[model samples]
Target chain A: MSLSISLAINGQPLDVALDDPRVTLLDLLRERLFLTGTKKGCDRGQCGACTVLVDGRRINSCLALAASLDRAEITTIEGLAEGETLHPVQAAFIAHDGFQCGYCTPGQIMSAVGLILEGHAGDDPERVRELMSGNICRCAAYKGITEAVLEAQKAIADKSGAEQNRRDAA
Target chain B: MNRFDYVRPASVAEAVAAGSEPGSAFLGAGTNLLDLMKVGVARPGRVIDVTRLPGLDRIEWLPDGGVRIGAMVRNSDLAYDERFSRSFPAVAEALLSGASAQLRNAATVGGNLMQHTRCAYFHDLASACNRRVPGSGCDALEGENRLHAVLGWSEHCIATHPSDFCVPLVALDAVVEVEGPHGAREIAIDRLHALPGATPEQETALAPGELIVALRLPADAAAFSRNARYLKLRERTSYAFAVVSAAAMLEVEGGTILRARVALGGVAAKPWRAPEAEAALEGAAPTAQAFAKAAGLALAEAQPSGDNAFKIELARRIVARALTLASEGTPAAMPALPASPFSTKIGANHVA
Candidate 1:
């Protein structure tokens, strides 16, 4: 039996048909939709290489079924940047050299964005390291990753703080 | 994953009707179930999606000063909830300690409770495992079992339940509300899992087609909020399962313990509640010596099923450490590394 699901992937509304019920969100993105930015590492939930934002929360897309996510808003690595500008977390990762070989970079950046949005990534590097433990980097780039998350967190905070001030001045 | 007919039920009754079908399995966030299916350990003919059930996603504060948490509540959402964390700090800590942030964000409370053991033999399709296929000889009995159960194990199976969240819930005497084809019923959190006596295949007390609706934390469970802590020992600093874990909660009056609750994880087929150890703590002072005695009593019946004799001593020490931390009181805020032994502070103040 074929199933139909509608979802907003990378802010673009898309309707898809699934002839098989076993298609995971990761496979749906990479194979069917051809949005290959979300990498699949272990295919199991052990690796967070397929991390994506579902309804503004970071989740392992490899573990989630596509049919179960009807009408859900999914943000992948391709959705992080605005036009030519990169998201602060993406910029910070490059500035801090947060990855080597770069296979885990997309998941790391997405997870960091989710962490900051959740307000769990405080100014403390230890908290960032602990919260980002879900995303593994085999290159041993944790030191850089922690630094990048802290910088990006502060950047987002400052930007939001300025926006609040603008509203106050108005 | 094998091909299956997917059904998304709009209501609880519809979900129950669909779930009661033969060879049908309920699918939550699929963090654990999908993984097992990929490994060929689970092959359901029909996949019933219950994530859309309306009332099963709320956290309600009962008028009786207790809390009713829906089974569909995500692990991270429940742990990070300000009011819930303030009241049940140990449970929050245990939730944060189990899986990674991504997995926790997707995993639901009911899914966490229904997660299977992490025994390597059970997941290896080539290995013989009674829990996977009944009447098959247990391969873990003579395999790599350095982390198997030591407290409750028969020759048939030696696997330990791998949930960190259940440890504190069992200590708090939480109640599980379930609905099935028969009707609605409640099971004490401690009795939800079964010991591997002769039927290792029967992991939980849940009957066929039964779905966990919600979990209730009784009014009295909050009484230990001032003195509750969950401590876990892991193979790594983070993102690892517990080698041994303990949850200790005490009600101290005038420097003497009025009531005590202690439970252990990663040591048995289910979350092990040490009633004898808790009884030993009553009317006694909250001292390290007293904690040591209680810890010894907690592991008195523990025996190594394989080359894991060191787990017994380790479990005992962790129990005493958890008790000491509980007596010191919960931290004003959760630590950076929640529930890890390295996050221990000598003098943590109680949450106000």
Candidate 2:
């Protein structure tokens, strides 16, 4: 039997054709849809390399079956940038030098984005470490990862304030 | 992996019927099942995904002030839910202690409860595992029993329940609600797992066609031990199996133990509740001597292996320390795995 699902990906409505029930959302992205930015260091959930957002929640795409996400909205690493400008989180990673080999960069960015959007990321390093402990880096760049998230927090705060001031003026 | 039929039922009845078939598995989180499938530990012909079932994704408060956690509720959501933190702090703490944020986001409550053992012998296809194949024999018996079970182990199997959530759930007296061909039936949390006495093949009590709907827990003052703590002694800090974990629920009324429930992890085949230890502490005054004695009673039945003799001693110290902290109304100072995890450093400042 075939299953059809309507998904909202990157703010665009998509009707994806999925054939294999065992093929995970990670497979659907890299193998089927050519959204190869989401790296698959480990197809298992241990490595947070396949991070993505489903209905605004961060998940390991490697662990998520595409067939189960019927009408959910998804956001991928490729979808982080709007038009040509990078999302604040992505830019923060770049500005803070969050990665060495950059294989884990996308997953890190996606996870950070989810944390920021969910309002779980705080100024405390331990909180960030505890929350971001799932994504493993081969280079062992946790200090950079923490700094990157902190830098993003600052950027997000600044942007919110600027927007609030604009609203006040209006 | 191999191809399989997938069904996402919007209701409980449809899921129960689909799951009761000959070769099908309930897919909640898909974190463990799908990974195990890829590695060939689990190979189901059909997967009935119950995540979309309308009523199964909620956390409803029972009229008695207890809560029924839906099977499909995500672990991340449960860990962060304000209501859970207010009523069941230990439950939320245990959930957060298990996996990372992203993994927890994908892991469902039911799947975490039903996770298979972390024994390497069981997972590797090449090895002879009683779990993977019924009569192939347990390779861990004669092999590396370091991380294997010492308590509640039989000749047929030696493995530990890997989930961090079940320990707190079991101590809280949770009830597992299931739906099958006959209808729905509620099971005590203690009965969900069976000792691997003769049949290591049968891990959980869920029958062929049964689907877990939700877990209902009763309010117990012991489970809300503000002094309650989750101690996971793993090889690494994050995303590792428990080496010798303990969940302590201690209650002291005027310096005497009114009630206390001590449960151990990574030492037994299931989320082991220590009745002998609990009995020992019932009337004893809350002190170091009493706590250590209770720990000794709890570990009296432990049958450790050559590689893990330290675990027994370490287990005693951990249990004692956890009890003492909980009794004194102090937050448990999370025990760190010895600086030399793979060595014989084997002491946590407090003598075992």
Candidate 3:
């Protein structure tokens, strides 16, 4: 049966008509919305190539049903930037060479951002590597990925700290 | 994937009513069900989305000092909850050791318990699997039986239940709360899963349209809060299923064990409890020899296939090590996997 859902994708309101209830969130994003930044690697939860934020939590979009997410706030790879400026995770990945083929880069950055927001990306590189095992980099760019996650975490922390300091001074 | 009608119910009664329809399934995280549906392993005509049901997602503390964890509680939230982690560290450790961060964030407690096996034959449509298709033969019994069961397996099926949460729940003596057409009822964790006997199709003990509501830990289980350990032996360091996992809980008083609970996973159709081992440990000193003897009794009836004979020995060692770690109040270190004859290291020259 076809259903209608209204949700926010990357901070933009979207009203999607489901042709089939089995349509996955990944397909809805890539095919329906034309947001092709999210890659479908395994189409299974095994590989986190379809990672996206639903209500600020990272989940595999390939396994999630688009119709089930009626009013959820979704953030895709395209939503990470502010006009011309890239998110810290995206910038850190470029600086640290966190990608080789760049297919899994979007998922990796989204997962790293979720990790930092979830309070998992601490100062320990080993912890970061373990937590990021969901997002597989077939190119084996794990060394750079781990470094970039830690760097992005520090950058985010510093920016928040400076903001808090400015607020206090004001 | 086949076409299916989806309904997001607002309340538990509506969810249960929707689930009563024939060829309907309750959808939780869709981490496993959606994948199986994509591969044609499961074909449901309708899916009831219970994710939005109110009051089923919160973790509450009972007046008896036990925890009542809602079925919709995400695996990551349960693992990271301060009260749950402090009260049941072994459960948190087991949850963290099973899946990746993304999966844990999506999977729920009820969905984890209702997850099917990771048996390759069961997932492959081309292969003959009795569990997937009744009257069909099980190919895993004779072909690539390394990941098959070493206990509680019959000629019809040899699939192992792939659940890390079940091992610790069995050890903690948890109770499963369910609501069905009849009424609300409670089932012991050990009685929740059935052995793969003649009818491998019947996996759980729940009746049709019985939805799992929550899991309740016993109040008396607080005695094991400090002296429990979960040890999972996997082929890789992380994000892999267990080869042999053990959850051990010991209640000691002055160097003597007052009570003991042990359960094994990845080697049986369900979480296999070691009752003889627990009985033998009571009133005995928590020593290496005592643990070894208890572990031996636990695997006395293990019947293994040709390729999975090694799991019997592996489970014995894991049970002993887990008991020792629990008695000493120390966390178990990740165990190194046994070197397979076909294993080879990737050389730098091979990388492009």
Candidate 4:
């Protein structure tokens, strides 16, 4: 038996028949929708290569069953960009030379977005490293990743007035 | 991942009913379960998610002074909640130390208590594990067993419960409140997990359809809030599993010890509470020598295996340090140790 589920992927409606319960949402995204931007690292969920934002929180997509995530809004790296402009986190990653192989870039950016949005971005490099521990970039360019997240945090904080008004209205 | 029928229930009763299905399992925090499934370690026929249940995440302070933390309360929420931080600091510390930030955001208190062991043999399909397969022999006994349990281990299984949270919770005299096909009942935290005397597969006292609703910490723990810490030793300073750890709460009145509670992790199949150490602390002066003596008494009963004998010494030092730290007030953040290399090498190193 197949389960019919609807998800907003990258701001587009994704309605599909998830017939195989064994299939992870990561697998469904990569193999079926051809959204292979989310890399598959340590498929056992040890690494955060498959991290995605379900609604607003960062979740490991490898652990989620497509059938169980009915009507959930999901955001991957593909969703972070608006037309041609990169998300601030992505732009910062580039500016900070935040990656080497770039295989784990999508997850690193996704996690940093959630971290900054949740106000976990702090002044200390150690704090940044600890909070971003979930995403493992095998390229071992963590120093750059940590710096990018912190720098993006300062830039975002500078525009806090507009965001605060938006939040207050909501 | 194995094919499984999925059910999302809005109520505890509905969740318990779904567990009546032949091979169905609860799916609150899917970190452990789904990961096991993807790696071909677990293949449940069905899964029932109790995450969305309304009252399941509530942490209600009872009129009796105790707190009832709903099973669905996220680990991050549990750790940061002001009530938890004030009333039970060790529980909060344990919660924070258990996993990485991403996982803590998703992991629940009930799921932390119900996590399975991380035996290398169990994770690797090439090796036999009794916990994974009913009749299969456990290869960990004679195989690479540095992470395996050194205490309360049967000849069959030697894996320790991989949670950093359970040890402190059990020591704090917490009770597990569960609802099942039958009415609700409470079990002591210590009794919630079963020792692997013979049947290593039976890890928990939870029945087939019993669902853990909340864990209740005794009201008296608040009195000892001044002197409590969850000290962990890990392969890495962060996002790492405990190698040998101690959770201690020492109550000193005037210049003498009024009471002490100690429990150990990373050394046993179950959370090991040291009543002997607590007895040693009674009527003792608040001194480093006194703490050292109490720690020695705590390890008196420890039966360490060949490679893990260092754990006894490590645990002793940890308990002493905990008592010493508690003598001071709430400590500053623990200094991060130099994280060791990520190794595929399997051996018990007392480096931490």
Candidate 5:
């Protein structure tokens, strides 16, 4: 049985047809939409290589069925940057050398962004490490990854705080 | 994964009716279901998506001052909920200790309770697993059975239930609410999961097509809400299944124990409640010596395999420590312990 789902992907409306109901959000994004920035490591939910933001919440895309996510807003790694300017998380990854092979970088960054937005990435580095344990970096680049997340969290917080202040002044 | 038909029902009645169809399974969060499907363990012909069912995502307070958590409530939301965290600290801590942020965000309370075992043999299709295929033969019995069960395990299957929330829920005396073709019914959380008797495939007591609605915690348990603790001893600090976890709740009055409840995870086929330990702790002084004696009684009948013999001692120690921490009103977090020589031998793979 085929089904049609309407959803917004990275701010763009997408109408997708699923011939098989078992198609995952990760499969649809990578194979159908050609958004390969979200890597698929384990197909199973055990690994967080396919982490994506659905309605501003980080979730394992590999476990989410496309049909079940109708009308949901999805943000992959490709959607992070605006125009040519890199997202603060992307810039922090480069600054901190958070990747040895770059395979798990997209997932790590998405998870970090979600963590910061969820108000979980506090000043404590240990808390950040605990919250980011979902995304695995097999290269053992945890030190760099942890540093990158901390830096990005502060940058994002500062920017949001400034925006709030500007609005308050207005 | 197998080709399947999907139906997203708008109402609880519609969902239950659709779920009553043969070879149809209700889909919630899909964390474990998708993984099992990919591995050829579950082959449902139709999936009834119940996530869209309205009124099933609420966390409301009952009239008795207890809480009713909907089955559709995400693990992350319930863990971070101020009311839930305040009233059920052990449950919240256990929820956080189980999965990572990403998985918790995607996982639902009902889905976590219905998750299958993580026994390597059970996941391997080629291997003989009684839990997977009844009477096929139990491979984990003699082969790499380090993560297998030690308590309440039968010769048919020795797999352990890998839910952190369930341990504390059982200890809290929670009840599960479900709806089906008949009507709505409530089952105690401890009775929801069945021991691996002769039939390992029948893990849960829920009849087929009975949809879990919510879990209700009684108001009488409020006294131990702040005094409860959940201690998980895994291979690493995070994102790992428990080797032996303990959930302890003590109701003390003037330095004397009024009541005690303890449940264990990663030690048996289901959440194993330590009735003997609870009985031993009643009316006793809240001391380390009393906790040690109760902990010993909890593991008195434990039967471990060759590779998992250490879990017996591990479970006992964790129960004692968890009780001590609960008595001291300390939040249950990961405990620091000396390195174990048996960790490597027990296959502590860094999968996550």
Candidate 6:
């Protein structure tokens, strides 16, 4: 049965006519919508290659049925940046050389963003590593990934803090 | 994935009505069900989406001080809820220890309880799995069965339950509430998962078309919040299933153990509760020797189903270690890697 579902993909509202309930969010984004930035390494939930934020929470898009997420605010890798400016996590990945083959970089970066937003890990490298364990880099670039997450989190935190300080002064 | 009729029910009664169909299955986040469908292990003709069901997402604190967690409550939300975690630290730890952060964020409490076993044979379509096909023989009996069940096993099925959340819930005497065509009923967490006896196919106690509405933890269950711990041992430091895990909750006072709740995971088809172990700890001093004795009682009936005899010993040690950690007291803040053996503050010397 064809189903009409509305979603905010990358902050853009889209009314998708899903032909089949079997089409996962990963497939809907990659196949139908042409948002292939979200990789599908393992369609199973085991690998976090399809990590995306639905309502500001990180989840494996491959396992989620597209038909079930009506009106959900979804943020994909393509939605991370504002115009030419790269997201801090995306920039930090480049600065820290957090990827070798770059297959898992998008997922790693997206998961890092979600982790930073969750604010559970703080500045602890160990906690960051543990939290980021979901996004696996077969390239074995964990050291740089961990380093980039710490740096990006600090930068994001500082930027927000400065904004708060400016607001206080005003 | 096989094509199916999609349903979006707005209310619990409507959901139950739609879910009562012969080939209908309730969809909660689809973290596990979708994977099963992709793997061809589960092929339901009708997929009833229950995510939109009303009033099924709140964590209600009863006047009796017990907690009634809505079945649709996301695992991560429950784990991170400050009051919920503080009241049930071990449950929070167990929830954190499961799957991945992404999975926890998407998976629901009801879905976690309803997740199938991760036995390789069960997923392999070529392999004969009695659980998947009732009359079919079990390939796990003679195949590579290193991580198969040790406590509860018939020649029919040797699979073990793959849940961390259930281990602690069973120990703390959690109850499951369900709504069905026949009306509403409750099932104790321990009795929810049936052992793979003559019928491994009947995995749960739920009748066909029954929908789990909520899970409740008794008011007194929070009494052991100060000294409850879940300890999991696996191949990897994080993001892996347990080889042998244990949840230990102790009510200790004046250097003596007043009460204890013990449960084991990755050892049986169900979260195996050891009432004898809890009995052994009562009135005994909280010591390594006492913990060891209780651990021994916990695994007394344990015997190897295959090459996994090591798991029996590992399960015993994990129970002792978990008890030792619980006796020491829960940490003020959750460890970086919840429930991992390496994450605890206690050193190797302290492990009994």
Q: Per-prediction fnat values?
A: 0.81, 0.70, 0.73, 0.48, 0.78, 0.79
- Consecutive 10-residue window with the lowest summed lDDT within model 6 chain A: A122-131
Tell me the deviation in Å of residue B39 in model 2. 1.1
lDDT of each: 0.93, 0.79, 0.87, 0.81, 0.87, 0.93
How do the residues A2-61 of candidate 5 rate in per-residue lDDT, one tens digit apiece? 899999999999899888887899999999999999999987766688999999999999
Give the runs in model 4 whose Cα sits over 4 Å from its true position: A162-170, B332-352
- Once superposed on the true structure, which residue ranges of model 2 sit more than 4 Å away at CA? B221-223, B328-352
Q: What is each candidate's DockQ, to 2 decimals?
A: 0.64, 0.50, 0.55, 0.43, 0.59, 0.65
lDDT of 4 by residue, A32-55 (tens): 999999889988667899988887
Residue B195 in model 1: lDDT: 97
Error in Å for residue B67 of model 6: 0.3
lDDT of 6 by residue, B1-352 (tens): 7879999988889989999999999999998899989978999999999988998999999999999999999999999999999999999999999999999999999999999999999998999999999989999989999998999888999999999999999999999999999999999999999998899999999998899999999999999999999999988878988899999999999998999999999999999999999999999999999999999999999989999999999999999999999998899999888898776452221222
TM for candidate 6 is 0.98
Candidate with better TM-score, 2 vs 3: 3
Per-residue lDDT, model 1, residue B248, is 96
TM-score of chain B of each: 0.97, 0.91, 0.93, 0.92, 0.93, 0.97
Span of ten consecutive residues with least summed lDDT in model 2 chain A:
A121-130
Displacement of residue A58 (Cα, Å) in model 3 is 0.5
What TM-score would every model get versus the actual structure?
0.98, 0.93, 0.95, 0.92, 0.95, 0.98
By lDDT, is 2 or 3 better? 3
Show what share of the native A-B interface contacts model 3 retains.
0.73
TM-score of predicted structure 2: 0.93
Residue B219 error, candidate 5, Å = 0.8
